[model samples]
Target chain A: MRKILLASLLIPALALGGAGCSGKKDAGESGTQLGGTVHIDGSSTVFPITEAVGEEFQMLHRGVRVTVGISGTGGGFKKFCSGETDINDASRPIKEKEALLAAEHGIGFIEIPVAFDGISVVVNPANDWVDHLTVAELHQIWMPDSPVKTWRDVRPAWPDREIKLYGPDVDSGTFDYFTETINGESQVSRPDYTASADDNVLVTGVAGDRDALGYFGYAYYAENTDRLKVVPIDGGGGPVTASHTTINNGTYAPLSRPLFLYVSTKGGERPEVREFVKFYLQNAATLAAEVGYVGLPARAYELGWQRFESGKTGSIFNTDKARSGLSIVELLSL
Target chain B: MTAGEWRGVPNLARRHWQSLWLRRLFQALTWLGVMLLAILLFRIARQGAVWLDWDFLTSFPSRFPARAGIKSALAGTLWLIGLTALISVPVGVAAAVYLEEFSRAGRLKTFIEVNIANLAGVPSIVYGILGLAIFVRGIGLGRSVLAGALTMSLLILPVIIIAAREAIKAVPQSLRQGAMALGATRWLTVRHHVLPGALPGIMTGVILALSRAIGETAPLIMIGALSYVAFVPEGPMDGFTALPIQIFNWTARPQQEFHGLAAGGIIVLLAVLLLMNAAAVAVRHRFQRRR
Candidate 1:
């Protein structure tokens, strides 16, 4: 009876304590009277860039809070279209299905190009039998039902060792972009490969095996160049290596793609959202380089600011097909 | 024969020496395993001791390694385990009681016994896929804490049931016979005798199962738990992430500092699991002392 009485008393006391804790958190924002929350979610590939921008934005506006989440590109679109998030970070342009869903929900979005990324095909540093690969070889290796199995299968003069393939999982935007550009269709590729949504895992897998080949965002390869070797690709013009200059100048061919941030126009109408998006565009070039991605040219950033400032809505590229091999200038013109 | 007895005595002494050496060898192997674990703990502590702080515990996750915290993930793990224990304990314990006490030896009992054993061994990732299909999408739970907990409950349910069954089986059969012989019904005998006697063992198994649930990341990942959650969950339907997922997200980053953060997170997770196990042992001790 004494224990029961103590428990009864403690339950109410605990309830009061919980209420007091919540009150403190709620009172914190009202004390400053300065900020609202900004929700951002999307591609892991673009996560570093967004996270950097969010950190700076939050520091500038102490009254504001920014939350960034990584759920891959497709997962972000699902939330963005349903009005769950304010901004969506995408590595590739929005697909038609996603755009239609957003339209149906009355979520008008402005697409802004933030940086240039080259999808790099990498091999272990110890790999000695290959220097470069043609687009045809990448296709033969990646295409579904293709019979390419060994290093010698690609070329008779190459080593006869079995080829170990590793790459991004199907959920990744990088996977979709690579497949579309190399295999002539999005989401079309062989089922046999070690895949991970995390680029570091793919990097480790390739780095551990001499016969392995994998591809991911250039930023990952840049960070782990000591362990992995980047392979140049021949795109009918000639073999070209992936670099800031090559990707930005459109010399990287087929693999050079611009990264994007899609903001909900409804979210833009809010003052915090407007200020944060403005801060993002103004500082993207600097922050992009800081995070290992090549920043877009000043003019591109200016155009992006103009588009966001003017309240322009709709995707520039034909959403039915992800437009590959297009320069930033070409995309802007379209 | 009298002369051979002298030789046999020496041979027996030699065999004793060989057996003693084998025992020493096995002892060394057991200590090696413990030494490996100690080395791992020391290495992690050396790397992450400076990084673990109050701010690291309270702050939300950040892109910058210095600013990142596992507050939400820690809270999410608490919510998940609490809900999982609530759902799995009663169901698992009840199932064990029914099988051990009420059910006769039959085909249905044998089938259940075999399947529960198999389910306990099913790879955790398969449970994740099952959770994704049945709870996340089919039931439209949408990656909430409740959905993740339900999936986790399913994943660990088999283990709990198997453990509870063993505890129930260990209850002295004579005690049940005595209660039934004293004019008590089957339910009365189970309630007064069997459950109390098995409670300590059942608690230990349940706690261990929950510790495993707390470390799982794959099923939650498959169900699309966000890697970054700024706010603590206030309700079951809120989106959440767990400590293992947070550690995984941090470890996968290319930056070197995040590796330290992952180590710190691991230390925190181990501490939580250890505390839980300690509590279980304390509770068992209290019950044993009362008896």
Candidate 2:
């Protein structure tokens, strides 16, 4: 009976296997309408905002194919510089190396600051001793070869227990921004820790262990406030917790940074891409707030629209290296 | 009288029709299953076929769906399976051998047997949590290749032992008796005859178990495997990513192109599974011929 069953199962599978041997072309062209594929890929931090825009934009322009991908900021820039994507979502401004690569590929892009994001340091809800962390303390905990091992090591009054660290993986813009701003260098944090590109994993990791400490986008912390405690940061002006008021007013200090969408000059020339960018800017402030990011101020939005309208090319951060810990005002002046 | 009673005519047409219906039902069910598999294979192939090239296999994962490759993930999977096999095979086989040959049945034995059976039925993700606590935290192995392999080894150990035990049970009792009767010690007789006879079955089980381990993404995820690993693991202690995790990451991305890449990753995984099963069948066939 088992042999019969086996043979009966195998025969049809073999037949289907033979049928599957052939292939088909993915012809995406649709007959006569405003239609073209607009590919967007970038930081998962920026993913929620782009996805909201992409969905609403698609609803209005049914003929256009808008796709969004979360490849982390660095990975997105890699694709953007290679001319593979129409728009690149970034949690931070484009780095000097990324701009150089884009120039090398002759891929001129316009950078539009879309929103403000705060990277929130968090610990388990059970962690009561850590009300806030100083920048020097963050450096002590995360800087390469630092001596901070236990909770007691961070402060003299805390309990003695191993500090289980979790953070974004190297691919993440969050990791880059955090290390750059706090440790005063990019990708220079200590190698020992639990890391994931997905923020939820880190959230779960930190939430599960009492001694666990981690950081991710402020939106994630806000969403998981019940399970995790967001740590206030003292940037030499007393501890300031991440909030809409603090993040929007730029009082969130070094952790508060602008999010962006880089549009290719060639792509913007296309009617679909041009219309989409216009729609994106008009709705960014509204959608940004809806997605838990601070909408850029009215003036910043105007400047962004102006920049896009003028076909502004090259990055405002035109240097050949990452400029860390810069405020939105400083970036705007530059 | 008895002969006459037994000679009553069989219900020929009824029996024939009943058998025919049963056979048709089986065929229909089989085809239904086959249709589902065919649809899945067809969709994956159509989506990913264009992207399945040498570069896709060899290149490191990039943010650009087109530039992203599975080099790190592919290498990590091979390393995971290799290390898992090394750890589980010896331990699983030994446990099976001791349970089958070394001891008499008792409450202790019964308890172990029932627990092993239950362990086989536990969800894979639960094992991931266990590994995170025991290996990643308790043992401080971190989320390295060694840690993942150890976790996977535990996940598949019960299945391997159960398979090994069944294989060992099938070895003829007389063969062991014959070897012992010829002045061989009990250990020698079991080792030389029983173990040799069960080798093919045990090997088949181990390979199939390893294949299942390779396809697993949950426990690895729970233990904090990186979603994007740029470099291949150089040592067992180094960080790594597997094919399933990479596929999951790509599919989770909002981009249509990465969805295609995820499909491509699935195709590669299916191919690896098929290869392992083929090897198991070949080994079984070779052993059957020798017997």
Candidate 3:
């Protein structure tokens, strides 16, 4: 009886899988039409915004389905350059080699800024006296071999308490940016911070501990304001709090960054693609702010549109490489 | 016999064309399939190969993505496999031995047999949800390594049990009768003879299950194996990451070096997978030699 049942069940399943194997080629072509499923993957950091946009975008254009996957920035880029996705939401700029791979695979792309952000430093709301910290102090706290293990060690007036930390995981772009700014390199930090890809965990961690400090994308701090304390960084002369005014004025001190969305140029000529991108940039200022991050200036969007139309982006931004612009000291204001 | 003498028809000689054509077609199709598979593996190997290195394997993930390593993740995966083997091997083998050797062929047993088949066919993701509920939340294990291991054990139980039963059932019934005729107890015959012969196949099944568990991401992720860990877990209660988790994390970055790193991580994973399969083959061959 078991033998008969096994034979009856297994034969059809194997046949079906074998028959359906031929359908993979036709899957990518019909994707431009309405009601089609646009499978988007990558960037957990950018997921909320894209998901929010995808949700409303799908509703506005009925029959069109958008599925967003959070695979992280570089992971997303591989998929994007492989032509597996329409738009790649990235937390950082594409590297030169990634562009080369895309080109090798016939994946032409355009980079557009969706919004601005101030990568906020946060702490548990109970840490009262740590309203401001110097950039050097941040270096001391996060550097590989620092003697400061406790809040008391950081400052004599502060409590002699163990300093707990919660931050983005090693894979996070936020961590990348913070490490670059604070350590003058990427991923050089004391291995004491409890890390997670989900910002919510960091929020909860800091919120639950009075002595704990955390850092993540600015939007997270803004959304979970009641739970965490946003710390001000003293660039050099004055301690600057993170705000729309401060971030816009470029005084947020080392935490301010531009958010980007990379779209394949092969599909960029399509009307739906153009319209979608236009909608994204036009609404980015409002939508990004609504999602608790700073928006880029109106002119920034205008310039982006002009560049897209003209088919020229400044060659520097077009390719990723270290240019002879300035030193870290020169680029960042003290 | 001559073809003409056998067939009694002139056209019989020409029928060889049809036979030749069919054989040629089958051979061509088989080679084509093999070639396509080779191409796919080559592409995957090329992509994942660049990321494999001692530095990549040993280091913790960095903001740069490519510099990230799988030290903690490797440790965590090994631990998960160890715990899973501890729980699953005995339960699966015992259930198989009972159903195949001792249990009376009855309606109740038949019903149990059908349910096991059904369980084997259920999607892996469903097992993930079951693991989340039963082991993680129901048992209140709280996203620990133990919780992840328990979920994996459940996922592979049906497959292991089915494989074990098949191995046990394949043994000639004459051997069982011979042992029984010599005044050997039912338990002793099963223990000494049936088990040794079945051990090879059962081990193969368990090894395959372990290999599948190593590559599994969804259930592990659902059970709270987060994307980053600088330190290897010291116990089942500690937070952990796995090799796939690290690979997935690195591959998600847009950095060139990171993509390279991800490719390297894939190479390492494939190597681990291949080595385990090789070990399984060696074990199976050893058992066959004894038989």
Candidate 4:
């Protein structure tokens, strides 16, 4: 009551009246007893899993609330290392320098593999006869320096079509991976492709236009299978379509990567954060697959639970609070 | 009246010489300001020069940030600015001309004037969402460069219209009075006497609007400009990228090399902006001095 009165009194003084409060009311209403807010942001690719897991986690653990924001992978990491979020949903692993930034900020986090995703190559269903494409053809289509202007330019025997393209924006991890795998560099792509941070937009673009091709997360393609066709990416020899089986068996090429959620060890000691992470690992598998992401083996969640349990005992955690001025170059070189 | 009185001002010259102290003080302050401005521009130019070069402008981003060129971004910015100018200049000038020369002082005109004034302060990012809704999604333009240009035109329109009005207002009333007296219609008087006088000021406003549009990151991002474009765009509708997007992309990367690249991207952008400003100032001054 006093807090509410104080807030009312202080309202006019707030040039920053629109607060960017990260606390979730349903999760953490108290400044004590696991009742503080847990803010999670990053990776539209990992957003579905994070959102699904966060919703269920909050439902199960009534006292702990979680909110997830999808700002792409690199964008999420920037906020994560800035200490804006307690957990970050990342499509790719923390790069050498990102790890150092977290260390510099005294933020030690536990990296847990939540699920797996296979980046899917989608084409308009109107075109037939084309089933597989080599990495060289992908280079022809996506490489920054490629001179190929049309589908026939890619392969002269194919019908001459003005190849329309769509893909993720540069800040996306999937874009980085596609560029690395296809163009032999990260963040390098043919500028001609229609780009968006949202995968749904890419799906719509590919589905609406004939002679168009796009790449996005497999789940989007799966959901829109009736409207769009999945082109098999040639993995050296045979064509490979991203499936639960193929992706799990490691046949989806370099684009198949593990999705992650990093829980802050320091923050996890708090009841709400601890309860939320515990609830997350406890039900993540079934709920993850329900949200169209591949679930990991049962043993993984069990180990994570054990770690979370050990964390309360002050044994399983190495708090970054003690490491002031930790060498960034040293940590990154590791 | 005949203007021959200034030639007989021998005694008036001595009186004017008494104004020398004020002129000397003004010159001193002016020199001080000029020095300060030069220093500021020098600092900005030097910092930006670290990243501007032929190779730097032409290369695509690599793992090593130093190797990345802003060719696609430069190309995209040019297309966006050129298209934005094409849409805005004629439209904004026409609106200004109508408002100044045609629209009588009335309720509707006052409403429009107030609204245009209010629009000048409307946050740029609002235009982004508007573009997203109207151009990208609603009209199904779908993140095309045309959509971005249309959004930018809306952003800079207020400033152009306002500047154009001021430019037309600054024209001597005698010029219009003379043109009308010579048997010209109102339209003819404005076209023959006013527009020629206002062109330099309109160009100045245009160059300034283009400057604001080129540096704006929010609306463009909202309308879906690419950050890592690989190829140069050839048409208005082609998927495009720009300099600010490239700078943002590089700044967000974890690599140290990218930080340098971000700084470099900033330099290239500033140089283009400076060039545009310098050209506009020269044109405006040239025209003013000629008249």
Per lDDT, the best of the predicted structures is 1
lDDT of 4 by residue, A188-283 (tens): 888878998767678878989888889987777766788888888885757888887777655666556667777666777777677777777877
Q: Highest DockQ: which candidate? A: 1
Better of 1 and 3 by DockQ: 1
Deviation in Å, model 2, residue B240 alpha carbon: 27
| I-RMSD for candidate 4 | 20.5
Q: Estimate candidate 4's RMSD in Å.
A: 22.7
Model 1's CAPRI class is acceptable
Residue A131, model 3, lDDT: 70
**DockQ, cand. 3:** 0.02
Q: How well docked is model 1, in DockQ terms?
A: 0.28
Candidate 2's DockQ is 0.03
Per-residue lDDT of A1-334 in model 2, one digit per residue for the tens? 2244345434644654543232111122433345665777777678767766776787687656565555567767887897867889888788789998999999999988889888999999988899899999999999999798999999999999999999998878788889988898878999999999767778889989999999988877876788889999999899999998899887888788788899999888887898889898899988888767888777777778778888888777534332555555456545
lDDT of model 1, residue B12: 68
Q: Show model 3 residue runs off by greater than 4 Å.
A: A1-39, A313-334, B1-291
Alpha-carbon local distance difference test for all models: 0.85, 0.82, 0.72, 0.72
Taking every candidate in turn, the Cα RMSD to the unseen true structure, in Å, is 5.5, 18.8, 25.0, 22.7
Q: How high is each candidate's TM-score?
A: 0.77, 0.52, 0.52, 0.48
Worst 10 residues of 3 chain A by lDDT: A325-334
